[model samples]
Target: MNPPVFKPRLSTSYLIVDDHALVREGIVRVVTNTWPHAHLSHAASLHEANKLLAEPGASFDTVVLDLNLGDSDGIQTLKTLRAAAPMARVAVVSANNDLDLALACLHEGACAFIPKMGSIDHFVRGLQTLASGGTYFPRDLLAQAQQREGAPTGVQPVAAISLTPRQHEVLHLLLQGLTNTLIAQELGISAETVKLHVSAILRSYGVANRVQLLLVCAGQDDSTAPQTH
Candidate 1:
């Protein structure tokens, strides 16, 4: 029997943001190889990224970002991109391996953090996961995060919470790093309804946002103590 051929489940549209030409080209090559039919765009700085994102008909499934761009740096870069393209999953590809920074990126809405020092295969796998509606955080960073002291306390597991069927659906998509607008489209519901469900889900988890909920789900921390509904 022949070995099975690998194929991506979806044709993704990607926006690669990096100030370094070589790094950007390397990511573009990896993405092209992994998903041969994928659509790709590029931005060398935060300003350029914002311009592309603001263009009419601009839409991307994922954004590969570097935190140390000439015009921006640190978690703020991820935050800016998140604001500009709320629907696109932002994956931070950086040389920095600081666990706190990685957690901060996740907390601020980045779906994945890919270390630029990692192997090509690692990058490929991260891209694959993101393309399939999943979030990717490096295991080493997650392990360090688990050992950190900042996780919330007293938060309950996801199964311990009572959730409506629709809320459950929304939660599933949310964990996959989809924005409210994306989840609304997926569930064929209004964004406001999705937002309500998200808020309820956060309350049930005793967390304030998706990142805290993710940490709780991953058994990271519960320092974010429960809030009364």
Candidate 2:
């Protein structure tokens, strides 16, 4: 006989705030996967979100709010929800990878920054973290900040001339333009994981792909400005 299969966990209702329909669907898929009994609603703008809250409705167990709402800006959007539902746990979902912005959001009491392309597991974990009374920053932002504090001279070069330790490694291998397999071998991780990191790096920097990522990574001097976030 086979062992019993596990069932999806259930939770209270959740709200999704995003201008994009597909993003809302993805959030629903991830949230419901973790909380099968969860009742969810979506809003395309801050106005709609407020209307939903004001209507005769049950309180949300948690709210996943987009910082860049169609009618609202980043941290300001978060501030509105804080006033709208003072008791609800709110998470900031955004694509902004700026360190200053991430810190500002956290300072303003956003429960987390849920990246659009971040894995579902990370997203769920962020929600859980908020549920547990902690805030969240994207892993990259947190890592970069920590490195700056613990290391010297903001990790040097201050521009494309310099690289974060990770970027340095990626740049070196990128110069070779080797197959994904070669880079994976040098890094000692699976090729697939490398691909994901590369994709994230490119997206964060708004580059076309690996070649551009490398080109941008190179051709910088010590005084050159580092890319945003």
Candidate 3:
């Protein structure tokens, strides 16, 4: 024999947690279309989800959760489910279009963030992306987020795209070596929101990480820097 061939794992099991029966049906439709042989399970509350997870041999390859469950806290539910089934890829299907919340879900171990208002095609794409082990954030969501950042304020960059005002604040604080949590506390925003801003900042600067950003900003004059709050 020349060699042994390795096959990719096919995702055949899924768990959907949402209080609304209609929403669960819609997601199940998407799943059926995408993976016709997939075994689907539904839970309306965190309690039900935990009960299912506690089953001795019951496990799903993927989990799609709602952020606003009838009996669960916001992102805490996602965190709990993630902790319970560490092997399953979690995706947040929420009505909340807040980019901050979406990013927060990702930070909390969700592999994908899908807004409920998206088209059927969008849902199919998101599910496929997650099942294939790639992180998915809708292209339109990223575009909308960047557009909402608006024009840059305070420090102007030599590069084409300037930093947004919030991003400028985040960058300045970051230059001071403030951690994300501290920056969130100082700015009166959630740490998840700060992470989104920081990610945008890094993208705008074309830097791989904070150290590179610091090196790029090292040459800039301090006179034009905005005063920290």
Candidate 4:
């Protein structure tokens, strides 16, 4: 007589790596609470995360990883994940008390940054968006970062990063906070084309969102960002 092996099924799997169980449990509960049908998994350290991901057929649709994982911390965690799962969507789950680290995570490869310290409603919305294939940057932090970085109001200031001619024009319009449709209307181009340029802009300046991209480029003394066709 032979025994049969049972196979596991996963509609979609999620991974989380953090040192704290409370944080991990909270997120696990939240995720399962929202996505009742999804298969959930976790790791307490970067090493454990690596081991899990290395196993064959071990796949995760979205990884809500903590940047400050015990031994593996900061932007390094992001870089490692990017190298490990180049195709997987990643969101940096972090404490909201710091903006600099969050921004740094964005500069890396994280498609979005989620602040863990917030109303459950807020965290839920962010998780939902991440699961739904969209970036989830904290709205309040994005605004604050934009305002602070928008101005070069600091001592020993250096010239902000510059842009190319095309980038210059696109970046300026970005400063206006116009949507792709509006930008196309103003530039007399297809909205789809405007999206292409915005994608390039995000890549060029190493920014995660348009607000940060434009804020960084707006400080430059450039007159080249063309307006209207």
Best-performing candidate as measured by TM-score: 1
lDDT of 4 by residue, 22-77 (tens): 98898888778767887888899888988988999988766788888777977898
Candidate 3 lDDT over 23-126, as tens digits, reads 89988887787778889999999889999988999979778899788788788988788778766767888888787786567556565678888687877777
State the displacement of the C-alpha of residue 94, model 1, in Å, after optimal TM-score superposition. 1.1
Error of 3 at 117 (Å): 1.6
For residues 4-87, could you state the per-residue lDDT of candidate 1 as single tens digits?
322212438999999999988988887787778889999999999999988999888788999999999898888888888776
C-alpha lDDT of candidate 2 relative to the true structure: 0.60
Off by over 4 Å in 1: 1-11, 149-169, 176-209, 212-229
What is the full ranking by lDDT, best candidate first?
1, 3, 4, 2
**Candidate No. with top lDDT:** 1
Candidate 3 TM-score, true structure as reference: 0.59
Candidate 4 residue pairs in clash (backbone atoms < 3 Å): 169-225
What are the per-residue Cα lDDT tens digits for candidate 2 across 2-74?
A: 3332221223677889999988897787777666777898999999999988888558756788888779987
Off-target runs (Cα >4 Å) in candidate 4 are: 1-11, 148-229
Q: For each candidate, what TM-score against the reference?
A: 0.71, 0.54, 0.59, 0.60
| Candidate closer to the true structure by lDDT (higher is better), 1 or 4 | 1
Pairs of residues clashing in candidate 3 = none
